[model samples]
Target: MTQKIEFIDLKAQYRALKDAIDARIHKVLNHGQYIMGPEVRELEERLEDYTGAKHCITVASGTEALLISLMALGIGPGDEVITTPFTFVATAEVIVLLGAVPVFVDIEPDTCNIDASKIEAAITPKTKAIMPVSLYGQPADMDEINAIAERYGLPVIEDAAQSFGATYKGKKSCNLSTIGCTSFFPSKPLGCYGDGGAIFTTDDVLAKACREIRVHGQKRRYYHTRIGVGGRMDTLQCAIVLAKLERFDWEIEQRMKLGARYNQLLDKHGYQRVKQRNDRTSVFAQYTVFVENRDAIAKQLNEQGIPTAVHYPVPLNRQPAYKDICHGTVTAVAERVAKQVMSLPMGPDLAESDQQRIVAALSEAVKIGGF
Candidate 1:
């Protein structure tokens, strides 16, 4: 019997970086300033420099990053935010949580990202922001989206949870729009041991607002300036990220090379996969491909000791919570793609042998399942 392939191989990564990770964690344990230790500021400064963003505010989680950004922008009741319907719920959840409305937009059929061309028509008087999610670590068309937002006097937020190490038109993903947010969840391209996230922006005012908002909206030690939440990224998690950053560049390079290899194999096997644009690089948070009878294919692959997953099976607009909110909204592309998409094992540490096996299993599964 062959060994089972792991999806999002964090253990392999940990084994490789044990020395650095252990040292970093030990330092944090010794300091005892777990709340907001020196490592916190150190990691923030490093990320700010990495992305060329003037400010990088580490937050509790990816969801909090989006929520805080919306709060800082003064998005409240009756305001509308135009965003893609095919994304993790957090993108729209943050908008709706603040008493605002999330206007659903269809995605590009090939890339599965927000359709920038259709965005302009969605603008209305109540439109407060445009949030585009970089699905599967590939960025949406940021330049066109930004231009549209500028024309309409609206801010654009790049939900870059999966695209942290990715680049778009020579710039980093988390620094591409008016405000950018990313996650450090264990499966992300650049992840910490546990939940962590960051927000990036060049605007000083927005930066200050985000910092205050993360700390109960306090400008000083206990003087609350605005309503806020307890959303600070713990120092230990920051320290873990700092250690991971040591080899992040190499990891990113591996991801790109492996992603290209997967694409080649899939294409050779006559499988359809997500298309990455020439102007950008995806970290390949999940190397997903399209198939008919996705559930049957996944079941066959699992039986063959190949782990398969779905980035999402349901578009947010079609969910019970959002269906009524986006009533009568048509997102044909997103709905169709959701049913066909299936993710394969993907990570910086995935071996070429494992990738070949995954592709081979997928091919067999497709044949066996008669799809």
Candidate 2:
């Protein structure tokens, strides 16, 4: 009998680090400083050093990180943020929640990242910032995007929710642009046990603003300086992340090795996947591949006990909530890719035998599904 395949295999990871995680959690429990505790600051410092950023502010979630970054930059009503329509709704959701507009752009078909070349044309007088997502653990064209932002005097926020451990041109993902925001959701490349996120920035003013914004916009206790939300990451969650950080480097290395192996295997089987660029390193957060008859293939795979998922089935611009706002915007690439992308089982602890079995199942499924 074939062993069951796990999509993310977080349980295996937990087992590998159970002792450390338990100790960290127990320490937090004993201290009773559940909010804004010492572990929170310690984690922040470690992340700041890891990413080479001037400051790191822990937040309640990835969405909160984006909101706080936008709030710190004074992005609000009547403003516009240019971003791809291919990413998770959170990227655009934060902009809309601020009563701002999200200008939808197309993606690069091969990489599924925002097409940086088209960004300049999307800029308008009302455009406040450019938010580019590092989709599927790969960085967007940051150098090119940053150059365009500089030309228009706009700030660039890297939505690095899936690309935490990735690198772009030798710099870490969350330290690549003006303000970088990343998620620590349990499924992400560098995840905690629960919802968590962080914002990285080099600017002193922006960093100070983000720190305040994460705590109800208060510069000090009970002294509100600006409008904000309750977005602080819990102390226990921070401790969990700190414990996980101990093996993060090793995990990233394994991801790279496995991603390369997957690429080679898929190529041999005549399967197509998201292409990783040479200048940057992707952590392969989802290990997604492009396929025809995605629904049918997924169904066939599931019957064989192989897990599969779709990172996104619809482009944000085509979604009901955003369609009217971004009316007439053409994202042909995003629309086409949405129908073809399917994520496979991926994790640091994935065994070679499991990977081979997954590919074998996929090969059979593709043939049976007539893809």
For model 2, what is the alpha-carbon lDDT of residue 345? 94
Clashing residue pairs in candidate 2 are none
Per-candidate clash tally = 0, 0
TM accuracy, model 1: 0.99
Model 2 CA deviation exceeding 4 Å by range? none
**Best model number under lDDT:** 2
Candidate 1: worst-modelled 10 consecutive residues by lDDT: 321-330
Candidate 1 lDDT at 199 equals 98
Estimate TM-scores for all models. Answer: 0.99, 0.99
**Tens digit of per-residue lDDT, candidate 1, span 197-259:** 999999999999999999999999989999999999999999999999989999999999999
The sequence of per-residue lDDT tens digits that candidate 2 reaches over residues 1-371 is: 65678898999999999999999999999999999999999999999999999999999999999999999999999999999999899998999999999999899999999999899889999999999999999999999999999999999999999999999999999999999999999999989888999999999999999988888889999999988899999999999999999999999999999999999999987788999999999999989999999989999888878889998999999899988776227899999999999999999999999899899889999898755
State model 2's lDDT. 0.94
